[model samples]
Target: MTDLNVSVSRLSPHQECALHPSFKWKPVYNLECVFCQSTLCVRGMKAILLADTRVELYSTDLPPSGATVLVEEDYETRHCECRIKDIACALCGNIVGYHVMLPCHPCLKSCNNGHFWMFHSACVQPHERLDHNSNSILLWGSLPTSTQDDQMHSSDNLQWTECCR
Candidate 1:
């Protein structure tokens, strides 16, 4: 994977122009829930400035601005719908959840189990998440569950980790 840039760098001026200087892109990894094996939602991406392809993580306590972070790849032009903004497992980049951006939120299990999920609303089915419904709800940092099987990060004392719904 490419190195990450967590610094507050200059927003890609080239983001507006088709012609511009070459900029290196980085791959951000998402964290998944141990229970239900679902990807949890997470704070939005924070753009940072850097000298080169190397990435330097800043304060983790900082909250991400809730917005869609664009990537080097075009969501509609460069790839198919699934490849556009598909979310992947943190441990493995498999198609775990859907998103309109790369490294979308964590699995749903993370949310339903009270685990912190990191995802953009565009990444999942409309009916699956409660935030999208007209219920006038806000479930960030909270788990999204439809069944009793949903459990937050499994116990550390257990011999195995739970990461599925």
Candidate 2:
């Protein structure tokens, strides 16, 4: 047998979520993946949600047709579906994450996994459910580059920082 990550989802109301005042419902440490420990960072440091997270929607290179089927579902008022799409990261040459095509963006996005196909009302256009034409297809790009001194940087550098000053 293998170990599975245990978790609790005590998501509450009156916290900021996709649109309403509701909790963001993230794991402890305001983190994403505990294993890889990669959360969207900006300005050379950790990014706090909303403090940093802006609702975004990625338009697909294809018209949501050429991708492979993954999963789909419907609730009393919402629906979702996942698809596999090809994507490339601009920073480094690595691949990750599902191009999860949801019938809607109210579902999951980023977690222990990097941001997947997710969207909020702000990311969508008015009078429409999806702005697929303007959205960038979600993809696992590249891991953050690092230096010998154990510092994470965007570009390639052989020299490492001495003490992270």
Task: Give the TM-scores of the predictions, in the order they appear.
Answer: 0.20, 0.22
Stretches > 4 Å off in candidate 2: 1-81, 102-115, 118-165
What is the C-alpha RMSD, rounded to one decimal, of candidate 1? 17.8
Judge candidate 1 against the unseen true structure and give its global Cα lDDT, from 0 to 1.
Answer: 0.27
TM-score of 2: 0.22
Which candidate achieves the best TM-score against the true structure?
Answer: 2
Please give, for residues 79-132, the per-residue lDDT of candidate 2 as tens digits: 234333433222222232224443233334433222333322222221211112
lDDT of candidates 1 onward, in order: 0.27, 0.24
